[model samples]
Every structure is written in C-alpha cells, then in structure tokens.
Target: MLAGKRILLIIAAGIAAYKSLDLIRRLRERGVSVTPVLTRAAEEFVTPLSVSALAGEEAHRDLFDLTKEAEMGHIQLSRVADLVVVAPATADLMAKMAGGQADDLASTLLMATDTPVLIAPAMNVRMWEHPATQRNLATLQGDGVAVVGPNSGDMACGEHGPGRMAEPLEIVAAIEARLASGPLAGRRIVVTSGPTHEPIDPVRYIANRSSGAQGTAIARALVALGAEVVFVTGPAEVPPPEGVTLVKVQTARQMHDAVMAALPADAGVFAAAVADWRVAKEATSKMKKTAGGLPVLEFAENPDILKAVAGLEDSRPALVIGFAAETDDVIRHATEKRARKGCDWILANDVSAGTGIMGGTENAIVLISDAGAEEWPRMTKTEVASRLARRIAEALEAG
Candidate 1:
C-alpha cells in the first residue's frame, strides 16, 4: 500500500534522535519516499548531512530562509506529503503543538498541513508522566492525532520508568499502520495474549515463557488497520499498546471469560499461550514442604476457548484463528489442533529452548489451513503481526 507514498519525517531534539536514521532507512527499504525536517534543537543531536544521506533527500531545517522559501515554500511542502510523522517528539515541542504555537518550521508545517500526523514521544520519565504532559496528550488524542509510544525501559538519563522512544523498527511499523486503509474500520477484533498462570499455592504457580509480544503486536496491528481492538492479556512484561481496550487476566479461565464476554466480533486471534491443565483444587493456604516424598497435584483441563468460540452459532466471529506452540513436529501438531479445535487457521511455531522464540523478539511460524501449511521465515514479532494482518485482510476481502 506504501509503494509510492510520500512521508514527511520530522525529527525533534532528544537523545533518541539517532533512531530517526534507522526509521528513514526502513521506510526507504519499503519503497516509501521521505522528506526530512529537523528542528533547530534537533540539529544539536544529529547532523543534517547524516539525516539527508539516510533519507536520500535534502533535509529542511530553517523556517526563515528567504531563498529556500522562494524555491519550495512551506505551504508547498505541507501540501505534497500523504502523512507527517514526528519522531522523538520532545516535551517542549508537544506543548507548543498542542497550544497552537507555531514559532518554528516543523510546528508551522504541522499546523498548515491537512495531512494526518503521528507522533512518537521521547522524554524523561518525569516529563512524560507530569499532569501537564498528560493533559497535552489528551488534547492531541482529542484532536485525532495518532500517538505511538514512550515505552518503559532503561533510559539514557540513568532513570527508568516510561518515556524511552520506541525503537526504529517500531516507528516504521507505526507509519505503515497509519498509511493502511481501514477495510475493517468499523469492525471489532478480540485478541488473547501471553501465557496464563495456574496457581499451585499462595507463593507458587505454574506458567510458561510466552512473552505476549506476538499477541500484543497483533492487537496493535489490527488497530492500525482500522479495527477497534479488545486486547485480553495475561501477566506480561510488555504493556498493551495505546488506543485499544485492554483486558488483563492471569489464568486460563479468566482469559476464557474475557474472550467470551468480548465476543460477537469480526475476528478473533487466539494467540495466548493458555495453560492446558490447571490444578483441580487450589490450596487456600501455602502448601507445607514435604519431608519424605514429593507432593502430588491433581490436574484438570482448562476451558477450550478457541473451540468454544468456533462452535458458537450466533456470536462467533467471521474468522477464528488459533496458535500452536510446539517443540517437535510443529506443522503436524498445528494441523491436528486446527481440526480438533474447529478453527479457521492455525499458526504454528517451534518454542524449543535456546531458540529464543518463546519470550524473544523474533519468530518463525508456519501458517496451517485446510489448503496447506505455509512456512514463514524468521522475523520480528511486529513483522509477523503485519504479514498476518494483511493476510487476514486479504482473506476477508476474498470472502
């Protein structure tokens, strides 16, 4: 969809300004053309030459260059692009944008352009969390501007909470999403994510290493594609993406209930690594240590959420997809799971130790359907989510 798209890239001043280079490269690799605009403060962090080299076009910096304005005016510049993206959106810049203060070129263009604006905020944790920033964010959202992330992580300033800029790859993905046309604009999608916890006692529980990255990405991707998303997640380290309804859960049964309550949707992506078995009877108090022998646990099967939804006659989604995380015979297990669960499609992946795929960043998946199994190469979870989302859109169009 982005083959000939024109993107106006605006870089704001911050330590995270360096990531805009990779963001430019990723967009160009996707055959999208970029025109760079750097704030005066942005010049302190990265050179115009470096940005221009990566963008393959001249960088626009000054708002008051008489000769440059004559050649290509700000009005002309703002009218040409299909979308405008601001990376490392600083606290100062966002405040000005929200307040309609256009003292600079970038802010002036943003105000002049009818083009949709997307921002990825990067600042200190304190600045991001301040009530003033929150108010500004609310104003932006109310004005229909898209905000991506200021993810929580270790910061360059040596303090950590929220307010680190999203990675370059993530920014690229966000742009792709913004450019995507919403065939499912009015539709609703419900997705389940992460590994469910089955409690053993007060202090202990059984769980898997599913990081919920894939599921969270799917929810964000669906939102990008214009679907209202309800993200049901288990205990996951990564926070849910912005602009979506979030349902947090801890156990398989809780996830099942959430999915069921959020149903009658257009699609369902069952990406959660729900525990198949759970303790039949949970111990109310902490279990004491056994001195002579190993303690035995009674087990029971958890509710089959996918199957239940697929079997629904009235409230079932148009498409129901399930996931199979297998160690051996991945495709075979996935195929069996599809038939047994009565799902429309099954995504199978090998989760062996040392693969780093379980809770890691990248994945290799085999998509199994009634027709056949299609193997996909190893890629980041975001990439996988994008391809899957497109495939889902194609399938819906075909149907």
Candidate 2:
C-alpha cells in the first residue's frame, strides 16, 4: 500500500531508536522509499551505517552538513516527502517540536515540513507522566499532529507503564490504515463550516456555538482521502486544517457565495449552522436602547444554501449533503429537510445546549437519506468524518 510513497523517518535520541531500524526495513519491504534523519542522541542507540544499510539509502545527519545542504536544501528535503514519521520521539524532542525549537536537523525539518506528521513518543514512564510532557502532548495534538503509541508495558528502564514505542508491525499497520482510508482521492469536495453571524448591529450579531470542529474534521478527513477541499467557514475558534483552501465568511450570504463559487465539484457538504434569519435592515450604527419605549426589530429569512445547490440545473454537485441541527425530533426533521432541500443526505444532530454537541468534540448523528435513517453512536468528530467519508465513497462506488 505504501508503494512509491516517500516517507521521511525522523529518529530521535532514545533507547527505542533501535526499533526504528526494523521499521525502516518493514517500510522498504512495502516498496516505500525511506529517507532517514537521525538526531545526535539517536546515534547513541543505533549507527548511521545500520540504518543506511536497511533503508538502502544514506542516513541524513547533521543539519549543517555543507555537502548535503548544497545538494538537497533542508526546506526542500522536508517538503519533498509525503509524510514525516518521528519514532522514539523523546521528551526533549517532543518539547522542542511543540515549542518550535529547532536546534537540530530533526526539529528543523519538523518545523519546515508541511506534510502530515505522525509522532511515536518513547520516553521513561516518569517523563511521559510529567505534567510538562502532558501539556506538550496537548499542544502537538492541537497543532494537528497525529500520535500513534507510547503503549503501556515493560519499558527499557525495567519500569512498566505507558512509555514503550509502538511495535514495528503496529506502526506499519497504522501507516497503512492511514493510506487506505483515503477513499475520496482525486475528488474535490467543498464544505461549509461553523455558525454564520447575521449582523444585529456594529457590535451585536446572531451567532451560535459552532466550533467548526466537525467541518475542519471533515476537510482533514477528505484530505486524507486525497481530495482537494475548499473549506468555507465563519469566525470559528478552531483552526482550519493545513493544506485546505480556506474561505472565511461572517454571514450566511457570504458563505453561500463562497460555496457557489467553488462549484462544479464532486460533492458538497453543508455542515455550517448558518443563522436562519438576519436583520431586514441592519442599523448603520449600534441601536441604542430606548428608556421609555420598546425597540422594534425585523427579521428576514436567510437564503437556503443547500437547496440552492441541490436544485441547481447545470452546476449541481453529484452529491449534496446537508446538516440538520435540531433540538427535538431530530430524525423526523432531518428526513423532511433532506427531501425539502433536494439533498442526497442529511446529517442530523441534536444541538440542545445540554447535549454539548454544537461546540464540543464529541457528536451523535443520524444519517438520514433516501436509503434510511441510521443512528450513529456518539463519536469524536474525526471518527465521524472518517465513517462519513467511507460511506460517501461506498455510495459513489455502488452507483
């Protein structure tokens, strides 16, 4: 599955560095080209010659090596690879990575690379349990770094807990799974995310707690499937995925225009909780509260973006998916919405404040479509995106 793929393996200074050698061999066996980068500390556990021998390529060491830099620039080296794998990533390396401290080749390449990075942390049980390490881990994860394992078991220090590097086979499996899960390859999918702000005044507006997590997750999942995704979002708290085409919009009208402009695509996923209504005439300035009389306000219906695209005669996407944010009778409402909007599918979610699904990491959704309404158990946004992408791919293939 890794055939013809270029994988840059960054080896950190740790006892687990020895296992990385086996990982190189396993990866090469799958026809993946390996370019190994060794940290100064990594030389303590394994030799450059051994790694080179297994990889069938010269081991990359010393960021300041004049000859190597002249031939292959560090920035170019980092950008050339499809993915970066950091095994035996020590606590020091993790801290450096999380903090953008590039004192060495590995850290420098890590900071320079635009590719997806998978870090397998290997450290002492105590070090891994340290608060600083935990904080660094959160930072890395929040920065969109993928973590494999620091599995709990007997460690090299003769201590047992969560500090072991994932086994070579396990790491290979994870990598392969990542490669295989990309089912939307070569397709262009446009997704609208977050809550639109309908201006109530200069300072006041109508908005919702849509963190944009699900939309960002959907974009990332699509990227994994090799899809070129245009993510139209509002002023979301969460960061958009790397390498995505991002369009920031504040109002429903702005989002609608962005989605329409990115048209003639394979699919469209309307995940944003766009405000249903906007002030009919927004005040040029903030409306002052009158002391004696009640202030009157008028609301106008926002454009139905999903219906607009689904009912398009010429540029309609092959698949149109809409999100139904309901507080009650979720399935019934979602089913009606799917038909009313002429969308192929509706992802229904309960967004009651108590449910915490609106701006939270976890979600419980019902997939309502012409086929049927399938209730999906609560899952992380990433997992939901993965399953949805797979289902979409299945539908496409079946047709």
Candidate 3:
C-alpha cells in the first residue's frame, strides 16, 4: 500500500538504533525509498556506513556539511519526503522536539518539515514513566505527531517496563496507516473499550466479562482506514492495538473523564461496559472476615458517559454509537436505549447463558437506528468490527 512513497528516517541515539537497519530493509522491500539521518550520539551505537548500505543511499550526518548543503538545502530536504520517522527516539530527543529546539540537523529537519511525524520511543523504565517525559509526549501528540510503541519488556539497562521501541514490522504498519488515503483519512475518532472496575474495598471490585476484543479490532480497522483514533481503554484482557493514542483508566469516573477530555472528535464508539454503581464510601483497608456481621455497603450511581456526550450542545461528536449487552428483550430494550441516550446508533447483542459471545471470539449484532432494526448474522468479532468501521466511514462521508 505504501509503494512509491519516500520516507526520511531519523535514527536517534539508543541501543534500539540497530533495529533501524532492518526497518530500512523492510521499507525497501515494500518499494519505499528511505533517506537515513544519524545523530552524533547515534554513531556510537550504529555506524553511518551500515545505515547507508542498507538504505542504498548516502547517510546524512553533519548539519554543516558544505557540499551536501549546496546540493540540497535543509528546508528543501525536509519538505521533499512523504513522511518523517524517528526510531529509537531518546527521551532527550523527544524533549527537544517538544520544546522546538533546532540546534542539530535532526531536530532542525523535524522543525522545518511539513510532513507527518511518527516516533518510536526508547528509554529507561524510569525515564519513560517520569513526569517530564510524559509531558513532552503529550505535547508532541497535541502537535499532531503519531506514536507507535514503547512496549513493555526487558530493557538494555537491565530494567523491565514500557521503554522498548516497537519491532520493525510494527513500525511499517504505523507508517502505512499514517499515509493511507482512505475514506476516513482526516477524521479523528474516540473509542472506549473494556469493562470499568468499581472498587468495593482495597482488593475487591465489580467488573464484567467483557474481553475488549471487539473494541480493539474496531480501533485497528479505523486506523487502517487512516483515522486518527484516541483509544480510551479499561483494564482489559486484550492488549491495545498499535497505531493509536491510548488512554488507560480503571474506574467509571476515570473513563468518563478521559472520554470527555478526548472530545471534539468526528465520532465516538462507546463499547465499554462501565459499572452502573460504585461503593459510596470505600473502606481504606481491606475488609476482613470478622465476628461482626457482613458489612453493608451503600452504592452510588456512576456517571452516565454516553448520555452526557450525546446531550452535549457544543464540542459533541457528529456521530455517537453505543453498545448494549442484553440477556432478554434485546430489540425492545436496545431501541429504547437509543431513544433514551439520544445517540445516533446502538449495537445490541445477546449474552445469555449459552451464547458464549461475551468473552468469546464471535459476536451476533443487532444494529438499531432511526431507520429501525437491522439484524446481522453471527460472525467473528473482527468481522463485526470491520463492517462497523466501513459503516462509520460511509456515515461520515454522507454528512
């Protein structure tokens, strides 16, 4: 899909810099021309000769090279590529980009570029979790930068956490998604996934059987169609898909706040199974079995996320979709829910005792809208997600 596209790859300083060599080969195999740029510190990890050899182009190093500057000015070079990627983006480099510092060639080119930017960050565990680095990441995202991964695993520093750069193939997928020209190309979407947990005590909580497979698949499909997705997920059984701005929350209130913060989107898919109520006064410590009778807990209603978003007069999404997991009277309840919530569409499903659809791979959906009910055949969750994504794209285009 990315054939004939040109990429300007900036390799920053880190142990993960070695992965860029394979990344260049992967891009070339897909008919993508890669122009490599190496930072001064990056030379210590991977040589310019190796990068140049794999890319089949001379690696650009110095910002002050007289001959290269005369051949191609920095401003012109930056604007010539279809996209610019920074692999193994160190914490320092990210801070520089966020702060708009152009002291070196890589930062200068980034500051001058009009093309979309994608970064795969690599740093120590502590550095990745640090407040400063997180602030810089948020700033870059606000400036329209795309991020792939800083996946959790073993780090070179002998520490283990979310500070590793994404694999070469994962980076390739993100690049393709960023460059796609499909129907949803310039749209920004918000998707909520998984079941929210409401604490009963320090260790006990209330949740559901939602696995989040459908929501995750939907987000992936939207990304493939070129929509920038803000994925707000709870503690789900499945990991989030690549190529999305992920926001993790635990409680219903937290999920509601995150969804609200991601507003002004083109559309919203509310698939999360949030708890209806929470303990009114949670115990500070774990409740123990004592001679005293079982403690009675008071419950308070949780925020109605879908209703609030749908009722918004301003900064509301053009299209709002909600999900209903029903055990009885599916059509009647879901249709009533659509009217009560004031959402554009509702995807209702039966999760009765023998259905095996709640935590299973398959889904049987009943789509409800103003035009009335449309029953779909039972299929895999992934298939349902793809179909839903196409429908969403068509809806936006019609508007």
Candidate 4:
C-alpha cells in the first residue's frame, strides 16, 4: 500500500515541524514518494534544503515561484498525488482548512485536491482542547479527513495532555490504511468486539474479561486486506484500528442497533462477549448504601444479534461468522451453536481458567462450519485474524 504511492506532505508551522523532516525520511524508506510543501512559518524551524535533501524532491515553499509554477501548476501538482498529508497540522492551519481558506500554496492544494487528506495535529494541549479547535477538528473529520493523533503526553511547551504529534511510523500506518488495496478492496465488513457493559447504575456496570484483542486484530486484518470494516466495539481494552468505520456501543441492545445500522455488509464477524441478560430496570441514580440490604435486580434477556442477522430473510450478509467461547465440550458446543444460530461458521475457543484465551494474547480455535469442525493450533490473536480474514476473502470471492 505504501510503495510507489505519492504523498504531498504539507508541513505546517509548529515546534513539531522538525518531526516532519523525520516523517519524510520514514515515508521514503517505505518507497513512498514524498513532495514537501512548507508553509511560510515552517521555514523558521526547518529549511527547504534539509527537506529537499531528505525527500530527494524540491520542496515547494513559495505560492508563486515562477520556475516551479511554470513546470508544475498548482492545480496539476495537487491532482498528481494520491494523498495529501498535513504533518504538524497546527491549530491555525486546521482552522483555515476547516474554514476553506486557500491563501497560500499549501492551503490552495488542500482545497483544490480531491485526493483523500490525512492530518497529524500538533499543538499545545490547551489549543488542542479549545472548544473552537475541537469544533474545527470535528468539521474536518466530518468532511472525510483522516486524523492520526495528537497523542496525550508532556508537550514541548512543558504542558501535559494530548497535543504531541504522533510518531512518523504511526502516520505511515494511517497512510497504509487509506491506500490499502487487495481482493477485498470494495468489500464492507462488520466486526463486533469487546465485552458489552450492561449498566447496573450510572457508575456501575456488568462486563466480562474480554480484552477485545482478537476483534481489534480482526478489524486490522480486514483493513489490511482492503476491506472497508465497520468496527462495532464495546469498552475495549485495546484501541480500535485505523482505516475502519468505528462504531462504539455499550449494551447488547446498542451493539445490535449498531450492527444493523452498519449493513448491508458483505460479511459479519460476531466476536463480542455480550452478556445474555441485562438489568430489567436500570437505576437512574446511584443506589445508596444501607438503603436496600440486598439489591434484588431483575434481569431480561438481551437481543440475540448473531441469530437476528444470520436468520435475516433479506439483506443478509454473504458470510456470517460467530465466535463461541466455551469452557467445556468446546467442539460439540460450537457445532451446536452454528446450527442453533443459523450462522455460516463459528470459531470456538477454550477460555477456561487455564486456557487464558479470554483476556490473553494467544488463541487456540476450532473453526466450525456446516461441513464439520477443523482444529487449529494455538497462535497469536493477530495471526488468527489474518488467517480468518484470508479465509473470508476466499469465501467471498468464490461466491
């Protein structure tokens, strides 16, 4: 996805501008063509010669450089690249972008290009958190712009919070996600992950030990295979992957709604550990101690999302895979689950105390389908996800 891809990197003015120099080197190392567009204030931190020396391409600094303009017009320049990245995207620059300002060459290219744009915001924590800046960020995100990060940490300004620019490698990952192309390029997939939290009260909830590692890995694998993934997640320990449509949910009912809204997907991966039941009547306020000696909470069965989607008469996914975490009779239980739920396949894992497959990194699974069950050796969750994603691609292609 990175090789041979051309990126127009717009270096905005900030202390983080220095990081952009390293970013160019990293992208080039990945065989990406980097074209640097340095804003006027960017020159204060880094020179065009340094950027050009590293990128092996002339850094475009002036909005009206006659020689460069004659050689490659601004419109042509903007149209040539597959993607435009704004590194060290300062608060001012982001505001201008959100406001549709095109006063300079960098801004002009951003406004002129139809190519997908990604930005790595870098600013003081206060600026990043300011209501106005947040509004601008929302506007850019709404316009389909991909954002890497303004990671929370100690800032160069000696302040703390999420204002640090993401490392160059992180930006590269974001780029790869946007440029991914493979057999599932145009396919849409829905993947549910993590343990749904059923609220007992405003401050209390019931949840499982599901770390959401496998589901997040699956989403990443699907994205790597060029599928547009709709990641419907709960309170996951791991953050969701890049380059996928992220839908955050809580209770089983919310997850069901999210999954339904994400259709019509090409495939569905039910990987969440949703609770079978929820509090029949949730407490609006915190229950006071000693008020009730013992809280007798009534429970109601949660929605069966897998069964609902799998048994769909219309708008059904071509492939529907469910996960069964069992403590005993794994194979038999999973085989029965596949039939009971009407799903195409079920990946069963032994999550008993010793197996450590529930909140652990490694997984041992049995892929159960209509034909029969196939046992698989223990492997990292990521490996399992990759293998499963490949199987999905082959299955989808076959049909």
Q: Highest TM-score among the candidates is held by which one?
A: 3
Sorted by lDDT, highest first, which candidate order results? Answer: 3, 4, 1, 2
lDDT: the better of candidates 3 and 4? 3
Of candidates 3 and 2, the better by lDDT: 3
Instruction: Estimate, for each residue in 1-399, the C-alpha lDDT of model 3 and write its tens digit.
Output: 989999999999999999999999999999999999999999999999999999999898889888778876777779889999999899999999999999989999999999999899989989988889987987887687887777768988899977889889888888888888888887888999999999988899988778999999999989988997878999899998876767778899999987876766899999998998999988889999989898898999999999999999987899999999999999999999999999999999999999999999999999999899999999999999999999999999999
Per-residue CA lDDT of candidate 1, range 1-399, in tens?
Answer: 578999999999999999999889988988889999999999999999999999899999998889878876887778799889999899998998899999989999988888888888999999987989977876775565766676667999999876888877766666666666687555667899988999988878888778889999998888777765667889987887755555668899989987875666778999998998999888989998778788799999999999999999987888999999999989888999999999999999999888889888999999999789999999999999999988887787777
User: Regarding lDDT, does 1 or 3 come out ahead?
Assistant: 3
Off by over 4 Å in 1: 185-225, 228-234, 237-399
Query: Top lDDT: which candidate number?
Result: 3
Q: Rate the local accuracy (lDDT) of all candidates.
A: 0.86, 0.84, 0.91, 0.88
Model 4 bad stretches (over 4 Å): 1-4, 7-79, 83-172
* Best-to-worst ranking by TM-score: 3, 4, 1, 2
TM-score of every candidate: 0.57, 0.56, 0.81, 0.64
Would you list the clashing residue pairs of candidate 2? 182-225
Q: Residue by residue across 145-237, what tens digits does model 4's lDDT show?
A: 777776667887899876888878777876787778798876778899999999999998888779999999999999889886778899899
Clashes by residue pair, model 3: none
User: How many backbone clashes can be found in candidate 1?
Assistant: 0
lDDT of 1 at 239: 80
